[model samples]
Target: MPIPAMTEQSDPLCLSEVTAAALLFDAPWRRFGVVGDSLSAGVGDPTPGYTNKGWADRVANVLQRVCPDVQYLNTSEFGVTTARTVAHQLDRMAEFGPDLLHLPCGPNDILRRKPDFDEIEKTMRRMYDLAARTRALLTTFTLGRAYVVPTFPDWDERIRAMNAITRRLGAEYEAVVVDMWNHPVNDRDNLLSEDRIHFSTSGQAVMATEVVRQLVYMLSSRTSE
Candidate 1:
């Protein structure tokens, strides 16, 4: 049986989705790198079967299908901003020397009070440039809907604005941007974890499937290059 491409428009994921993703996880990850924060840590999502497979983990599972030799080092922490991620990413690059990297951040920054957007941009540029120096390929993920409290006014707008800078940079630097904004899964009942900040087990699987779909496109485009 073929695993359907899951899309949730306020609909919860079914058992079949999880089964399909596990099959996809059979892919290899002998190469790759991951740079992100808590969300990237898979905090809001549950592990597959036994352990929780955060977005990065799920992304790795997907890439393995295409790049059997792919390997990744997830440096994303539970609570990290762009500035914090930038501070440590270069070090990871120096240590791991991976060919692929994933970046997910900014929700926490925006959720905080008086976060220095200027500093965030400065750090972000450094992170971007660092990828080039390390000869590493960078892929970034953006937030769809924040479940955290005191939701920022125009949350979507702010996320898009930040992503705009990322998008422009992606074009200039030739990076991949996976936009999960407006994804139906973000709003599904029990789609996210109890805290409402992360995705539940089913939610993780749903997100993982989407990321894999994008990764397929990304890998296809890269190989043609």
Candidate 2:
């Protein structure tokens, strides 16, 4: 099926709506830490009508509104792979002692000419193992279908493999997985930035909204339980 034309008015969710959704969660998280690649860094190009802030920052801002004392530490860097993230970012995150943590899903791991899924899984498991020791509410997002690498003809397959690994690890660690594989936002024509890789600010807004909603669901489920 073809995606419909997208316009400024066609954005699925606005920043105000993201804030509103976040306000619904009476979350207990006062410390948030994020680590991994550019995705974890919330890298994106600015859209005409959307805020340039990445999803992580937007989420952090919302959390700050809910808990004024909330401390956010994002040790993510652009162009870093999963293994490098484990090496460089994990210690800082552990030291920060976050009550809420966001881990990477290894988008860069599969960007290589011949990605070693076995090594990727091993490294990811190690990363998660260390992260779980922090006893934080872990969170991550699967890659959106809109994210692509024209150079890699098998990009879609690589993404599927990567997302599967993410889902599996996320489940093992009891992490909140904001599955974005086939999200409606992926249908937008303006989803990607000029790099044709990273999401645009519009996509970032939608991502932040979804993350808030998922966190609310987790909180709500705990309350009911």
Candidate 3:
């Protein structure tokens, strides 16, 4: 049977509902792997773990409730740049062989005076390749202007530039782009931590919700196919 091409009138809710049911009814074993910087590591949202349990861990917990055999491995390092992430993290991520992968970095790279976008794009493409090799669904996110590091006067332009790169690379690599640049939650002050850089516990919950929805949609759609 041939798969039908999606039409503009297709109802996304229909697909999502179907997928959610499949997760509940026909649960499959899965593994979720993560790479990139602090956000992926769940920096501000402290949970009871040797490593701080962030959104990725939260995501894993949700999946486990549905599919008890779900495994998770996170290799995110705080302040790791995109290039270094590709160099150091991708190998470990591939070795873990995750069913889905999340990479959300760029703040560390863009916080500098000069950001090499071409290099960043190159690194993103390479990481996407690694995801393909491991057969993991790649998900990436854009940063919003909720917080600014101290003395980084031009933080606005830097975030915009980094988000642009994230959008571009995400599209190019066929990864799910969590559009935080336009997410309504970013407008609230309560979502950020004291450092003005990381998300508060509530914020990480929101982030985890977004990721879980995406995973459900993705996995359910695959099952439907």
Candidate 4:
């Protein structure tokens, strides 16, 4: 079946909605730190009617609204792999001493001709371990099914493996996992950017909304405990 077109108006979760969802968390985080690749950096093409900000920036914006003192730092670089993130970004994020941290996934790790799943997992574990040391509430996103690379016939399989690692580690570390593998947004024809890799700004908006929702759930679970 052909995918449907996604416009800014039709988006179920927009930046405004992200703001509303973030407000649901009464306790404000003082420091928000993000470290990883372009996804963590919120790199994507701007959709005509959507906000140009990436998911991290949008989330940070709403977070700042609730707590104007929130200090935001994003050390995400384009095309950086999991290993690179560990070697480079981890220490900086640690130094930032964030109370809320967004971890990177394994997208760049799976981009090569022969991705070593074991090594990818190892590096990812290292990142998670180090980030967890800060005692911050960790968060991550499982890659959406719409993020595809046609040149690689096994792209779906790679994404699945990477997402599995993400889910497993997220659970192990008690992180908020925003599972988007089967999201309806993935069925949108325009979900991807011109690079056919990253999601467009419309998708980013949806992601920000989901992140806030997950954070709210986490907070609620904590309150119930």
Q: lDDT per prediction?
A: 0.64, 0.88, 0.70, 0.87
TM-score per candidate, chains pooled: 0.75, 0.93, 0.79, 0.93
Where model 2 places Cα greater than 4 Å from the true spot, the runs are 1-10, 14-22
lDDT of 2: 0.88
At residue 217, what lDDT does model 4 achieve? 77
Looking at candidate 3, what is the lDDT of residue 127? Answer: 69
Residue-by-residue lDDT tens digits, candidate 3, 50-92:
1234667767776676677889888999889877888998888
- Give the per-residue lDDT digits (tens) of candidate 1, residues 88-145: 6668655887766666646667766555666666677777887777676667766666
For candidate 3, the 10 contiguous residues with the lowest summed lDDT are: 8-17
Candidate 3 segments whose C-alpha is farther than 4 A from its true place: 1-29, 45-53, 219-225
Q: Which pairs clash inside model 2?
A: none
lDDT of 2 by residue, 1-225 (tens): 998645434655654644544555578999999999999888988887676889999888888887778999999999999889999999999999999999999998997899999999999999999999999999999999988888999998999999999999999899999999998888888889999889988888888888888898898898899
Residue runs of model 4 more than 4 Å from their true location after superposition: 1-10, 15-22
Score candidate 1 by TM-score against the native. Answer: 0.75
lDDT for position 162 in model 2: 96
Off by over 4 Å in 1: 1-29, 45-51, 62-70, 146-148, 154-156, 222-225
Q: Report the CA-based lDDT of candidate 4 relative to the real structure.
A: 0.87
